[model samples]
Structure formats: C-alpha cells, structure tokens
Target: MNLGCIVGLKEWIVPQDKAFFDLFEQMADTVNEGAVFLNVIINNYVDVQNQCHKMKQIEHQGDLIAHQVYEQLNRTFITPLEPEEISRLATALDDILDYIDGTTQQMYGYGVTETDDFMKELARLILLSTQEVQTAVRLIRKLDDPRAVEQHCIEINRLENLADVVLGNAIKSLFATNDAITIIKLKDIYENLEVATDKCEDVANVLSDIAIRHS
Candidate 1:
C-alpha cells in the first residue's frame, strides 16, 4: 500500500494517534516559551520556578503522546516506515521533553535566584535547539527530502555544541566563585541544561540515521 493509505488506516483505527505530532508541536512551544521566560526574568526565582512547573506539565503530556505512538506502532505492521525507525523517532521526541522537564526541575530544586551570562546563553541555545527539533519533526512525516532533515540535524548539532561550551564556562565560573552553596546549586542547574542539550543532539542523531537509512 502507499504511504497515504497506510496513514489513513492509522488515522481511522487510532483516533488518539493523530495527536502525537500535535503534542510534539506543543512541546516545542513550551520549551521555547520557557527559555524566553528564563531569559527575561532570570533574576526572579519565583517566576522561573512557576514557568518550570508549567513546562513540566507540557513535557509530561508530550511523553504521554510518545508512549501512545510507540504502543500503536508496535501493534500495527503497515507503518510508513520500519517499526524500529518509528519507535526511535518517538523515543527521541519524548527524550527532548524529558530533558526539558528535568532541566526545569533542577532549576527550581536548586533554588537558583540569579542568572549569569552563561545561563542566559544556555537558555538561548536551548531555544535554538527546540526550534530545530520542531523543524526536523515537521519533515519526518514528509520523509521524501532527506536534504532538509540533514540540514536540521546539522543545525541541531551545532546548537548542542554551543550549549556544551556554555556549560563548560558556567561550570568554570561556578568553581571560580568562593560561595560553596551557590556553586553547588549552579552546578546542578548547569548539568541539567547540558543534559537537555544532549537530548537535542539525540534527536538530531535519530533524524540523521533515518535520513541515511532511507536515502
């Protein structure tokens, strides 16, 4: 059967399944908004905490959609792509939300009140990564043009690397400071941000693999 027929069958049989992509879009929007909020009110710990909590809920919803997609893909054989590929893509998309949620949780748990330049830069990198992820996901349903996917993966990788540098500098600055408690809190936040970046790279890697395999 053709791709359209398969997708049509999926839609007819699985009513909730169609919402997976929409959830991903919501996840991207939440992350983007959270990043902007963090940048704008980095000094307001309470505001940051509230936004993080909101992000956590959004991420959890995204995770639920990913789980539903995974389960549905397992039961259905006539997928648009290999079952393994679909699983990988779903998992990667969920992973982004996981990282975003975890990062926000740490930001609150650490009671981080002040934002440094490095933290601002890290937030910006996260915004860029999520935007790239959104673009990549939009192309996954198309899958005809590997070139666009490749380009997105490249951009995601670059943003992830930039985040890595920011994380390193933040850590260095944390150590350079004499406040032990502050250093500890900031270190935890930095680590969580770094993990989020790594998750973005994971999404890119999955996209790259799909592109290469299908090309």
Candidate 2:
C-alpha cells in the first residue's frame, strides 16, 4: 500500500500480463487439440483408448496452465484484467478441456467401439466451437475491435444451438432403437458431448463479459 511497495508491485505485474495472455493462448490451443482428437477418434473408431490417453495429457496440460494463472493472480497486486475476470476465464477454459477429457473416458468405459454419424457430427461441432473459443480468447488481447470479438461469441452461440439439435435427434433415435444398454451407453456419451458445448458456451459468455467490460 506504500509508494515503494506499489511501485515494486507495478513492476512485477508488468511482465505478468504477457505471461498470462501467453498461457491463455496456449491453453486454448490445447483445448482445440483435444477437440480435434475427439473428432478423429469418433470418426475412425480405432485406437480409442490411446486417443483418450492423449486427451488426458492435454487435460493435464490445461490444469498446469490454470494453476500457473492462479498462482500469478495470487502473487501480483495488479493484473492486466480484473482479478475476478481472470479467474473466471481460467476456470471456464479449464472446464472445456475437462469435458473433452470426460467424453473420451466415457467412450472407453462404455465400450463404444463403433462410430455413428451422430457422434461424429457432435465431435465436429465441438471442434468448431473450440476453434471459435481460441479465436475469441486471442482476440481478447486486441479488444480494440469489440465487434470482431462479439462475432466469435455469436458463432459460438450458433454452434451451441446446433449441438443441442444434434443431441435431441441423437436421443430421439436412441430411444427408437430397442437395445436398452446401447441406448444407455450412447445417451451418456451424447450428453457429455452436449455438456462440452455447454462449457464452450460458458467460455463464450465469459469472453463476452470481458469484452463488454473492457471495450
């Protein structure tokens, strides 16, 4: 709170801004990679366990980045963005990876060795959503163009709606089939994919909030 302490704190935070944004971009990249892996696994229907392992690694990487973000938040007396916004964005980004990891694990646990069109479509939608997320997060560093940032958020919302429709039709088809256990297994996977988009929407919401505040 004293002058000298304040000056030292400001100096410390100067370097952290770049570091924070760098980590955020890296985290977004990793999440998008996970989504790509998920789509590949679903479309090919081979080596799923190994692919799930890869996604787990990415999820671990996201955790490490999130931890660093929080550690920096705690140590710095000043931040490039609001401390709460930083925390929210970090948490939201982490959740997207977490859901991706969850979907991969469920595929293995449910013995879903075959790929279906619905699953593939959902996976593709997830990939698209994450791509938008990455773009929007990077644009945060260039928020002078608020319209540009909001466009990405709008795309994310549209993708989320598309994912919802995919989920609905998937569940509807599953119920029409008489294989009860298969229905149960696929229902879980479908819901997880949907939840992943929901998390992506969560990221979009946080990004929108940040843009509004900082615009």
Candidate 3:
C-alpha cells in the first residue's frame, strides 16, 4: 500500500497514534542495522547500499505522515501534544535518513575496498546513536517522559563527541601514511562518516528541545 494509506490506516486502527511512532522506531533500527553491516565487511557494500536506500524511502514516508499529523493537529486545536513537538520529531527522524543515505553514497563513490579500525569505530558510534534515537522515540510514544528523553539525548551527544575525537585521530594518522591518493579518498570517506554522527547529534538536540518544552 501507499504511504498515505498506511498512515491513514495506522491512525484509524491504533489509539493515540502509537503505531506511527512505533514505525519510526523500526525505521531507526533498520538504519542502524545497515550502518553496522557496512562496517563489518567491505564486500557487502552493494547490499548495505541497497538496504540504506530502501530505509531512506521508508523514512521519507514516515516524514510525510508526520507532517500531515502535525498539520492536522494544528488545525484541530487539539492533539496529544504541542505542534512543535511533532514537527521536531518529524524533522529529526528525516535527518537520520538523510545522513544514512549520504554515508552510503559516499562509500560507493569513493570505491571503498576495505574497512579500517577507525571506520569500524565510527560505525559503532552511529549505531549507538541510532539506538538512543530509538529509545527516545519509544519514550515519547508512551509517557512523553522528559527525563527519559533528556538522558538518551545526553548519551547520543556524548557518543557523537567521541566520534569526533576518533575521526580527528584517524585523519592525522591518514596524513602520516605518506600515500597521497589513499589519504585523499580515506579522508573524504572518514569525513562523511563523521558527518553522519554529527547529524545524529542534530537529532538528539531536537529531542532535547522537545523535552525542555514539554517538561
């Protein structure tokens, strides 16, 4: 079925729009799995690329529904929560897919043939951040618990910070390797991976804002 139909059915079937949030959580998990697989084996690049692309499509559908829900909530003057909260959540979820798509495109464009320890670590961090995102979504779906959301946001931010340090050291080491061509390609790939982590932090920031406002 089409996205609108699925979302409409979800709104009709589930009480309080819980199923909508659950679908977003599943999308995050799918993206996380794709990130982890990308890091594990270089030969699996095509598979991960396809998977990430599919996940992006799903995420886009979710974003559309979120926008619709937000608009409906605004017009109705009565919703489960504030309009800003829904908008923030929708935008943050969309950002996650954008980052994932960017990472996959970079891998293919760079012709990455092998994985390194630093890249592996970055992927791990991305997975951790996505997991935190899933947690935040789950909490928001249920109690709208500000404290729980804040805790997960903090964890995501911390993980993103660690990714920055790891990326910096990796760049330094790459420069010292004395291979100009390799350094150029590796640097681009590393930077894109780091960018993905940064996007995750952006999502966390939005979630933190939602928590503050709702608290």
Which runs of model 2 end up more than 4 angstroms from their true locations?
A: 1-10, 13-15
lDDT of 1: 0.72
lDDT of 2 by residue, 188-211 (tens): 999999999999999999999989
Query: How many Å off is the CA of 189 in candidate 3?
Result: 1.2
Please provide, for model 3 over 116-215, each residue's C-alpha lDDT reduced to its tens digit, 9 standing for 90 to 100: 8888888788878888887786776655479989899899889989999999999999988988988988898788778877877877887787677667
lDDT of 2 at 28: 94
Instruction: Give me the displacement of residue 157 in model 2, in angstroms.
Output: 0.2
Off by over 4 Å in 1: 1-45
Candidate 2 at residue 169, lDDT? 99
For model 1, residues 58-158, the per-residue Cα lDDT tens digits are 77677766777766665654555566776777777677667666766776677766667777677778778888887887776657899999999999999
In terms of lDDT, the best-performing candidate is: 2
TM-score to native of every candidate shown: 0.81, 0.94, 0.74
Question: How does candidate 3 fare on TM-score?
Answer: 0.74
